[model samples]
Structures are given as C-alpha cells and as structure tokens.
Target: MFGPEGPSLRELAVQALSSVERGYDLLAPKFDRTPFRTPDSVLESVAKALAPLGPFADGLDLCCGTGAGAQVLTGLCRHSVTGVDFSAGMLDVARHRVRPTGGPEVAWVRGDARALPLRAAFDLVVSFGAFGHFLPRELPGLFTEVHSVLRPGGRFAFPVLAPPRPTRTGYWMLLGFDTVMRVRNALWRPPFVMYYRAFRLGTVLDELERAGFGVGLHALPEFGRRDDGSPRARLVVARRTQPAAGNVNS
Candidate 1:
C-alpha cells in the first residue's frame, strides 16, 4: 500500500527494471511514504526488545536505508551510530532526516555490506527490512561481514516475522511475488533480488553459528503469539563470540 506521496506506478516500473542500487536511489525520496520502509511499530518493538540487553557504546546500522535503525540505536547506544548503505541517494535522505537531539552522533557511510570499509568497531549492529536483497547462498558471507564489523561480545540484531502459513492469503501473495521476481530475473537484465520466502530462520541461525555468533531469539510480545503459542515475530540476537587463536578484534 502506497500513499499519494509515494512513487507513481510508472516510477515504480522504472525502478523495478533498474539495478538495485539505482532503483533505490530513484525511490529514496519517497521511500518512507511507501510500505517498503520499516514500520514505526516494528522499530519501537525492536527497540523495546533490545533495551535490556544494551547500554551499548557504538552502533552500526547495516544496509540502513533512510536511517530508521540508526534512529533506534540512538536511544540505546551512548557514543555514536553509523548507517551504511550502498545507495548514496538513500544516505543523503538519511543525513537530512535522522538528526537526533542530545543523543548519539549519527554518520552515514556509502559501502557494500559484503565488504564493509570499517574495522571491528561496533558494539551493536542492527538491520531492518533489507535482507531480501541478499540470496540464501550469500548469507554466510553476509553474516561473516556482520561478524567482522562487531567487537567481541557485540550483538547483531534484527527482527523476523513468522512466515504466513499455507492457509493464509498472505502466504500465496508472497509466493506469487517471489515467483514473479524469479520470472523477471530470468528475462530481464540486472536482476532485482527481492524474495519473500528465501530467508528461513532455521537456515539463518545455522549460518550465524558458522559465522561465530552465539544466536538467540527473543519474542516480541507486541506482535503477540500464534495459535501454536510460538511468537508471531522474533528478534534474532546474535552475539559475536570472542575471536579464535590468531584472530584480532581490529
């Protein structure tokens, strides 16, 4: 669902046809008006969930489009917050939009998440609504990059919704969306890599473990629980374990 301030259908078509970076650049200004932006409710829920675990120092928001996660980090992190994304356009908007008052200083960096430009400088890292851009095979490398950026005992946290069951219309809708994306990639140049079903929680936990994070899940009570008593949404809190022999924090 998009508001009147959101991109036009024609504009969206142009974006969908472009490379992911260029597409986001074009959509950056109107992103918050669209459903693509992480919802404020979700952000608040995650902040509440992370508050007890933190009194964190420096924080990083990986793939921080428009700086929503960075805004959250300001409340929990004491020193500084850095938002890194590949799209310069998105970073531009974030720099202008997310100024905090009497809180952690915020900075924006333009870089790929696969190869971050910084050292292991962050005590907490958060990402929101950006993982679908990465394929399942890329999870190991992506998680490793996240691990590398975090200080020893630092956390990499993000929220994941419980997948809609087959009985729900949302399930078919996501299935159809992914199928369309697959078909488009097959026929189009410079594939747009958004898939709703690709990031499974079980697979992600295993990858986090292999990347040397001690993974845990915290239920977000705001979203309530499913009929089976499992959480409807959860925050994956992956803490980077101390480095092995010969591995340095820096």
Candidate 2:
C-alpha cells in the first residue's frame, strides 16, 4: 500500500504500461514514499548483519534505487560507496538524498545491473529489493557481474524472505501477481519485468556457486521464524572466492 505522497492509482497505471526504465523514472521522485522502497527496518537489519564482515574499504550497491542500500553501506564501509542504477532519475534523487554524514564518501552512478561498469574494485556489494526485476535465466550473468566487480574474498549480500506457504494468503497474492505479470508481458512490448515469485532461493544459491562464490546464508533475527522453524528472512552472503574467468567485468 502506498502512502498519501506516493504515486496515485492513475500514475501507477501509466507507469505499469511503460518500459521499466521509464516507469522507474516516472516513479523516482516519490519512490521513497511508496511501499516499493526497501523498508528502514530491513535496511537496519542488513547493516547489522553485515557489520562484522566490514570495515570494508569500498562498497557497491547493485541496482541501488533511491540509495537505501548505499546508505547502509556507508555505515559498514570505510572509504567510498557507490550506488548504481539504470534510472538516472533515481540516481539524481539518491545523489541529493543520501549524503555521507560520517561514514564513507557516497556517489551515484547510472548503469545497468547486467552490465555493470566497474572492475574488481569493491570490497563489499549489497542490494535490496531489486532482484524481482531480473528473470531466472539472467541470474548467471548477473551474479557473474557481481563477482567480477568484487575483489577475491569480498561479499555480495542481500536479504531473502522465505516464500509463504500455500495456505498463506501472501502465497496466493504473490501467485496472482506473477500470473498477472506473465499475462501482461505476453501481451506487451518492452516488458516491465517485475515478478514476485521468480527468484527462487535454491536456484539462486546454485547460480552464485557456479559464478565462483562461496555462498552462505546468515539468519536475520529481526523477522524471527516460520512455523517450520526456518528463519522468516535471511541474508545471502556470497563470498567471491575466485575471479570470474570467462565473464567480462563490464
């Protein structure tokens, strides 16, 4: 649900019909006000989870919309932090909104996630609420890019919630949303690739390992656990154990 300052119903409708880039551009000004933005609680939890891994020198926030993750990185990283996104409009807002208070120097860059623009330059990489934009097949390339940009032993971390069970209303809602998105993409051009159900945890872990990361899952105590006793949410902390041999570092 959106706040009063968030996008209107008409505005959301128009955005849904546009290309992903343009839609985000149109939504950028009010993005932080929307439910779409990563919540402060999630960000705080991630920062706490990643803190022990740091005092990292430099950090990159992949698909860093509105700079929420980048702000988290500033606290953990010591030198510099960069927030990259394909949307220049989002980058512009991030530039103005996420200033370095006492941590690393922060900067914003406009770039596609699939083809990021830096080499083995970062010690830590983080992303929040952006994976739904990528399809299953793109995971290899995406993880490869993240691997290439990270120094050996560096981490690529993000939070993942355990999917809701079939009996839960949340499960039905996500299924319905993905079903709608599939139908929309089947009919529309320049598909706005946002599907809540496509990013499976098992598949992602395999891909991360294949892309040369030594993957691990860290339980985030904030969200607690499900009835099954598995943590409700966890941080996937994939360490770049080796260089991505065949992958070009953008």
lDDT tens digits, residues 77-146, model 2? Answer: 8899999999988998999889878778888888999999887899999999999999999999999989
Candidates' C-alpha lDDT:
0.93, 0.91
Global lDDT of model 2: 0.91
Tens digit per residue, CA lDDT, model 1, 185-247: 999999999998999999999988888889999999999999999999999999998552244
Task: Give candidate 2's root-mean-square deviation (CA, Å).
Answer: 1.6
Q: Pick the candidate with the highest lDDT.
A: 1
Question: Which residue pairs clash within candidate 2?
Answer: none
Q: Give the Cα-based TM-score of candidate 2 against the true structure.
A: 0.97
Report residue 180 deviation for candidate 1 (angstroms). 0.5
